[model samples]
Target: PVHAARLTYEAMRVGAPARRLAKSLQPLAGRCDARLVYAYADHASALAADSGPRLLQVADEMEQIGALRYATEAAAYAADAFAREGRQDSARQAAARCRALNARGHGAVLPAMSELDNNAVMLTPRESQLVQLASQGLSNADIAERLVLSVRTVESHLYRAMQKLGVSDHHKL
Candidate 1:
């Protein structure tokens, strides 16, 4: 069930058609697992529906279940939903909760949130892609080669991405 939820969540994250898959997994929300797969399923469904309120509810439930990782991921999803809805204050609150959870060492940071600024502003797509590669320890030249771009362009992208993410260096990415 947890694996199904994770697969659904990944599908939704990529903007794939996951509404049917999420609906099919809705019945598992009552089941128990070490990682609280039920809550993860609910969160994934809410994401598929673009429902911020439901995501927030799932985040609260995840916190109660001691699933800090899922809680933070849900909060980050809720933050993004709220931002898209023009609810800046609510988005900020959710993002702050996510940051607090990470700061307390409750769980690993969500990969999607890794490229956010201190205030949870999202990085551009190019910026996010560059940051992900750099975080994997790829050098500018290597990234350039892989992306089929000039080394200078790769460095520029990394520099701008790092600046937006508030990282002083690529090593920090």
Candidate 2:
């Protein structure tokens, strides 16, 4: 169920019109972080101009439910929604909420909040490992062998990681 929610949330996050998948989780709305998914789906429509406010409402509600992590993520999503609408003022407020949530918690930046932090680079787990390995002088083939992945896959992950790091060469990984 958690996996399903993640897949649905990711789909919605990437601008996929996967509301049907999100709707399927409506029954679980009051449990296991489903409320956030459902709320995202509700605001995922094209004309949902109130996404920031609505999502922030959900974030506050999640706080009352003791789902601080989800609340922070929802607030981050709210920040993005506001940014997309050119609402810089609202976006900054949402960003502040996200930071507060992070400080109140373990201070670990959640995936959703990474975009709100300019100092953070959003890297996939695989890309992070590839960068770490490449930094240690592991060739693509060596990384492939160590991780049981294809050489092409290793190269691809390294290429993307370097791009995210704004390095022109894998040697900088």
Score every model by TM-score.
Answer: 0.56, 0.50
- Colliding pairs, model 1: none
Worst 10 residues of 1 by lDDT: 114-123
Per-residue alpha-carbon lDDT of model 1 for 1-173, expressed as tens digits? Answer: 66666676667656666577677567655554545666667777787787768888887888888776767777787878877887766776777677666655454656756533433445567877888899999999999999999999988878876655446778977
Q: Return the top candidate by TM-score.
A: 1
Each candidate structure's count of clashing pairs: 0, 0
Per-residue error for 114 in candidate 2, Å, reads 1.5
- The runs of at least 3 residues in candidate 2 whose Cα sits more than 4 Å from the true structure, single-residue gaps closed, are 1-18, 30-50, 118-173
Q: Kindly list the per-residue Cα lDDT of model 2 for residues 1-173, writing each as its tens digit.
A: 55666666666556565455445555444456555555544434311444788778877866766768767877787888777777766776777787677667667867777666332345578887788888899889999999999999888887876655556777854
The C-alpha lDDT values of all candidates are: 0.71, 0.67
Candidate 2 C-alpha error for residue 81, in Å:
0.3
How big is the RMSD of model 1? Answer: 7.3
Q: Residue 146's C-alpha lDDT in candidate 1?
A: 98
